[model samples]
Target: MDTITHTLFGLGIYKAINKENMSKREKQTLLFTAIGASQIPDIDVISQLWDTSGQYQMWHRGITHSLFLVPVWALLFFILNFFIFRLKSWRFFWIALLAVFIHDTSDVFNAWGTGYLEPFSNARLTFGTIPIIDFVIWFIFLLAFILSKKGSYKESSIYRISWIMIALHIIIQSIQGYALYKQYEPRYEQLALSASFLPWNYSVIGKDENTVDIIQDSLLTQKHLMYKLQSSDNSNLKKLFKQNPKAQTLYKWSPFVVVVDNEERLGIYDPRFYRKGQSFLFEFIEKTQK
Candidate 1:
């Protein structure tokens, strides 16, 4: 999920809490706990400054996003609140824990995924069920906010209903994506899915031997081939890897990649991000260098 959505999640969580007897100091501590915990995992992006080996691809959503680190982050927040706000409420710690857990777990449903297991596993666990930016989620939360303002229902109750609706949306999208993925699973040696911004739509990348097919998939529509690629021999991977170590990292991080070896160059890219005749992740070395 995107930064804005995560921030909204934090705000929503804070708003959903019953604060009838809470002091101003207590409310401030809770607000910071929710927002900070939600954004903390993404602090790994700073690793890019020191990433000369091109491992930022693996490092960005790496250890910090791990499930093992959730409790660690929650403890840090709990201690910070203790010192800054003189907070003694154990409920504050639990709220921070929930915020951090939501941050890590929600990332798994998107195409970019995360190193949720980290040290125990290097796998980028992704469901590819939700787009990074989902308007459906935005709409649900916005509606909740509006209802909280004008409706007779309590603000916390409105937000709680919104959370339930959000979870249902994720489940529906996942089921749709899974159904589409199984369509190509039998035919392709490898498959990757990227959910479209539009609901119930997906981009399915299927690879078998030297060919890669990118298809627009949906339950209501027939699968449409958006792009087809032919993979080149990686026989000279030594040179390719030497020139673009990022490509190597991408290969290790991604579920699969489309290898490109042509008269001009050698490279590889994850087809899930393919668009407008090129991929955002392509890495290549000119053949002329050889």
Candidate 2:
């Protein structure tokens, strides 16, 4: 998910807490804990400064997002709040834990997955069931926020209801994505699904022996073939990897890639981000001698 979504989720979590008896200082500390814990995992972005190998693709959502690090982050926040807020309750630690856990787990639903298992496993676990920036989520939270302000009901009740609505939306989207993925499974040797920005819509990439099929599909209509590509036989992937280290890292980071080899160029690109005539994740090298 994007930063805005994460921050909103943090705010929602903070608002969901029952602070009827707490003082203004305690509530303020709670707000900081929720927001900070939600964003701590993204600290891995700084690794690019020291990563000369051009492996920032792998580093961005790497070990810092690991499940094992959730408690570590929570502990850090707990200690910080202890001195800064001078609050002696265990409630601060629990809220920090919830915030960090939500941050790590929410990332698994998108195409750009996180290394949730980290030291135990290096796999980038992605379901591709939801877009990185989902308008549905934003709308739900926004509506809940608006309603909560107008009502005489407790604010925590309103925010908790909003969380439930968000969960239901994710479940419905996941079910639709899984059904679409299974529909293309028998026909293709390998398949990947990327949820479109619109609800119940998906971009399905299917690869067979020598061709790749990119389909735009929705539950309401028949699948439409957007692009059909013939796999290149002349791609010397080892040479490409040697020439462009980023290509090697991309290959490792993504579930699959579309290899491009022609008279003018040799390269590979992740098909998930392929748009118009090119892909943003593409990396290539000139065929002529250096």
Off by over 4 Å in 1: none
Extract clashing residue pairs from model 2.
none
Instruction: Give lDDT for model 2.
Output: 0.89
Q: Can you give the TM-score per candidate against the true fold? A: 0.97, 0.96
List lDDT for all candidates, in order: 0.91, 0.89
10-50 per-residue lDDT for model 1 (tens digits): 99899889888989998899899999999999999999889
- Model 2 lDDT per residue over 1-290, tens place: 99999999899999899999989989988999999999999999889889888799998888999999999999999899889988767788899999999989889998899999998999998888999999999998898889888987888999999999999999999999999898889999978888899999999988887688899998888989998877674566898888888999998998778888888888888888888978899988888946
Residue 40 miss distance in model 1 (angstroms): 0.6
List the RMSD of every prediction in angstroms.
Answer: 1.2, 1.4
Full-model lDDT, candidate 1: 0.91
Decoy 2 TM-score against native: 0.96
